[model samples]
Target: MADYKSGDTASWDFEQVRRSQSNSPARRSQSGGSGRRTQDSQPPANRRRRKKRHFNVVTYILFVLVTSAILAGVGWLLINDLCAFNKEDITATIEVTADDTIGSIADKLHDAGLIEYKWFFRLFATVADAKDKIGTGTYELSTEMDYRALIVGMHNSSGNLNSDTVRVTIPEGYTVSQIIKLLAENGVNTEENLLEAAKTATFDYDYIDNNSEDISRLEGYLFPDTYDFYLNEKASSALNRLIKNFNSKLDEEKLAQAEARGYDLQDIITIASLIEKETDGTDQANIASVIYNRLEGPGDKGGTYGMLQIDASLLYALPDHTGPITNEDKQVDSKYNLYKYAGLPPTPIANPGLASIEAALDPADTNYYYYALGKDGKHHFSSTLAEHNAFLNSGDYAG
Candidate 1:
């Protein structure tokens, strides 16, 4: 009976130990192979490391793709900005402050409609090492210029307008009176100021000094040219430039040649001014020959037709005249009337260009004393007044 009790106690204790082992976590994992949790199959450290590595790879690929897209978009915009696709014909003056930077300049350009993009200009300026080379002043910028040209024009004080400036273009054959009117029209000077200066101011040119008393002496000598004038410029300063330019363009050798040809500088100017009004540039030399022929008289092919009969001189004498002269218009009481005077006009009626001056110095060796305007806008030269009258009545002459 003692042995049965001992066996029962031992069996009960063993049964309690088996039940505790089956309920524990390690025993549950070791007992079932296929029924084990997937996470429990591997070590905790290895499983955590694999999950972290997978997340990092996916994150890295997404970051690379997003970054590449951003970079490509930026590159396309930058390339588009640098190209010369946007062209405009706008002219504007940009006032750059001393404290302005490259980025600010880019903004100014963009606002002026001169450039398409501001950020790209700033980037370009930085890359090209031209950011710090810009100057601080009012710059004359035109949209007609390309991007590169605009940058170059504004770089290093190149297109700086220190003061207000007005550009005046003087066309050929413009007289002193016409230039005064032009200066007033261009806002360079007041009409009264310009005319007073022209009439009273004495210039230091050799051409003006010889005939100093006559204010109109520099009429044809003030060379017609394009000039830049300061706003409200002094009339003397404006006229001085014209005189200086005239002196610069006139060659001393050519003046000496004209003096050697039995004519003075005044004579050459007088003849040139007539040639300038008589015909276009192509017929100046031939027209000059006719003037010399008429003056030289019977020794030339021209007989006793001693009158110049230049209608241009007649028109100049009458300031209010606008159209062709009538028979009554020719009777105007002025020494400039070539029909009555039988010589060159008292003074040049207009400013002559270089071609006209050159033509007067070297005339064509022709015996053409009389010329009439033909239907082709060219002069029909004749040796006699009878032939000139015949051409005037013929169908070839429109006037």
Candidate 2:
């Protein structure tokens, strides 16, 4: 209790005082002497976080290595089967018919040992966007062919879509008989076999009406286009291909048009056949107008009396129609003779090309009831018989 001002210089043991303060709980904690460990003086959060980071890094590396191994193994399996690698030299004759789907064809290939896995092939087909590219035919495949080669080979033989194919171009106004003759001559099929197949083959078409008693039931349906047929192919197959092409041309748009025009496909085709035989391509739409006027329009006056008196209609009855019509030909008692029938023919006389078909669907607006081939190789339409007679006497043709 002595006052510091009195300046007492008596010194005690200072080391003993420091030792006594050090033993206290508050002093020990403050000086880090470890009476009881504080939160800051214990193992730090940063050190624990560093250990966790190291563990996460190891885990990420292991994950990447496992994923890479799995990917590599998967790629090896797909490539090996896709390329037919390490396969023995083998040959398999696979017949891909029109009825075969992706699954059926894959099954066939797998059974023949030409492929290993059907599911993988289906997946490849889906990825390649070739679910509908494979064609129908008997293909000879070898173990050396890869996935690309297999698809290319089956799509069209000889690795070309049209190579090694017999190209047959049917004219615009070609009859069924002429088409059969041309196809037969081009080594597509035998004429006798094609004739029989065409007459008897039951084609499934919603628009076709097979009510006619004729040797060629597919008269007007054989769309005139350049087609590539396999050599010595099945007659039915070739016929079906032509029919399919025709069906494709008459799409939903065309069908809607026909319905809008109040005309069915048969009527359109029959009228188109006549237009194809009459028009010289210069005034086809006008000729179509003349035909429409004569059939059912204002031009159906005393000029035609709703009797499309087209001389081309008589040609349908004559199988050997080489020259122009005569008076005797008009007397023929066939439904095809417009002079006797007073309406359209029983069926289309010939297969018309797209031009004539379009003209029939969309005719030029006119009052023409007659069209004559003039000397200028163009049609000269006339609304009256006097105008037609004048053109005939004008020396436009041999008439």
Candidate 3:
């Protein structure tokens, strides 16, 4: 090393030294020299990434515009279907099957010209929560109905052709003759045809076959229930429906239960008819117990003399007898007169429901021999005629 004096000058190619250091690879990399590339200059990885990004941005904008257009078109179509576009005065019938979905039903209505569009109907039904409420039937529709009206009409069963089908409710304890009149009143086939069918129509049931006497064979066999039948239906077919219902209700299990109680199906039905006439559904067992007790003898809460003085039996002889009984009424020469006969009547007086039949099959474990109607519209039961008379005269009963 040499110490520099004042005003001394030394030169050793300083610009060449700087140029060599700047040209090095490490310096070139840090300073980004002329040979270094910009983002656009590189055509391998970064350029591909930039191209991909641009393509993605353009594709996203295009996708959004296409989706928006599609949604708008669908919304317009739905609104058009829901509104009344072409109101025409026309009627159409659409048959809806059991397997028909709301969409299929809408298609049917649209094809029938009752509805404007199927898609709109499906959406409306879904929004109204009535998709599953649509019924299977032949519907009578008019094109005059609006969208909501059309949907509601389809959901209602009465809007269908099956509305002509009447609901015939045969109340319990109605006699065959009474039921005949009721059937006629409700636009069922004539009373004469119904009675003839009851007498002659052959039912394919074991219970019916066992006691197939032509006269009054269907007395206790017609199971009283609410039945749906086409208006003016065939008498035989209607009677067959009741007989089938009866056979179904009194299946093998019920028959075996009756047998276990030491009674056949006929005996149960006969007693059930009596109980049905004597009291309401609630007092069936009590009335049934009284009937059984009267049949069992004196020591068993019965009369030593075998006679069931049931007043309803007296009225059974007269088809339309009403109000209080007379002494003359009790002397009717019919075999159904309980005052003149021993044990049960030849057949039931009226059709009995399942509950009465059940009670007859399984009577309550009571020793009651008599029952009378009271002012409270309930049966006042007693073990003897004396107590029965006391209740009758004590003014506690309507009679």
Candidate 4:
């Protein structure tokens, strides 16, 4: 308390100040606290908080990794299942009856190895809204189709392309009887039954009656062409199909053309049939001109001749004629014999094609009255009897 010197009074008391600071509450909180710790106690709290935060972060990271792995595993399993079900094999001949139900068709598909499970196919069809979309008919299935492909094929019309068949080609000149024989030879139908059906076949009398009365049968009107028939088709059906095709080819225009040419429809067909038998090449128009010239030109007398004198007509009249023509065939006796008759035969001898029919109506412009085939199969025409005789005497004459 006494002022000794200014320097002495200003000097610090280290020991006393330290003792007082130790007793202060604020000092205790900053340093080592009392029985209720200060910074030391806060250190324990902070360490506990940091430990909790680290545990939470680690747990969350581990949970996210585990979830990602589980999701990847599920996705891979789903993809594998889909790929396995996409490829399947099928095989068999399925005959779907007209009254077959969807359930029955599904069962057939299962039996044919086209579907792995019937319920699956049924469900798929139902889901696609195609339960009643399937058609009823014979179906051919193979083993290389999958579920989707098989379903599509079942609804596709072209899937029925494969089937058993018998082919018969009726030539352009064959009669109904001959057509029946050809069908029989090809195992398409019984010859007797086919002939019977053909005889009763309905025809357009308007076309046939326009020509002549000699063609009482359907020989020339029956069109000739190749036909494809199923194994299950009946003889009557085949005959009807041919007749229908023939009718389709004979339109009113062709008939009109014949009429315009100063010939009846039947007469054109008759002449066309003759031309078809006389000539093998495409020179039917020329042959038809020759025929008309002979009919109008001078013959043995000054008057017009009445006979056509066609060899094909004579051959058609032969009895028991089974093969090629012979020299004796020209001498056969029948109303169809052109050598004996002065005009065209009663009807067409054979069914003529459209080309021959057109040629008969529109003949070529020529003055030739006679013609004969040469050794090279070319025809030699003559305007008079003397020239025709010379051609007949040539080395090309088959007679």
Best by the lDDT measure:
2
Which model, 1 or 2, shows the larger lDDT?
2
Worst 10 residues of 2 by lDDT: 155-164
Write candidate 4's Cα lDDT for 316-353 as tens digits.
Answer: 77635777666676566777977666777877888887
Off by over 4 Å in 1: 1-162, 209-215, 299-306
For model 2, residues 1-399, the per-residue Cα lDDT tens digits are 755732343334566676688567777668556466666655578779989999999999999999999999988878988988888888998887767888898899889888888899888877764543466677888879977777766763312223256788889988989989998899877898788778776666765544543555687799999988876665766777787788888756775887787778888888889888888876778888877777776543545866787887787788778877888888999988898877788788889988888888888999788777767777777888887888888978545
- The alpha-carbon deviation from the true structure for residue 149 of candidate 3, after best TM-score superposition, in angstroms, is 28
- In candidate 2, the residue pairs with backbone N, CA or C atoms under 3 Å apart (3 or more residues apart, or in different chains) clash, namely none
Could you give candidate 1's per-residue lDDT for residues 1-399 as a string of tens digits? 345677898999999998898668877778465665555445678888999999999999999999999999887765655665546578888877657888888889899888887877877787765543455567788767666766665654323445467889887888788888998898766888778777778676665754454556767877887888765655766777787777776767878987886778778888888888887669999999988888766744434455778888887778788877898888877888987777778788788888898888889999788888888888899987688889999999978
TM-score of predicted structure 4: 0.54
lDDT of residue 184 for candidate 2: 86
Off by over 4 Å in 2: 1-108, 116-139, 143-163, 209-215, 298-300
> Which regions of candidate 4 deviate over 4 angstroms?
1-163, 204-216, 296-304, 319-332
Q: lDDT by residue for model 3 over 258-293, one digit each (tens)? A: 788677878788999998888755899998887887
**lDDT for position 350 in model 1:** 81
In what order do the candidates fall by lDDT, top score first? 2, 1, 3, 4
Candidate 1 lDDT trough over 10 residues, lowest sum: 155-164
Which TM-score value belongs to model 3? 0.56
Question: Whose lDDT is higher: candidate 2's or candidate 4's?
Answer: 2
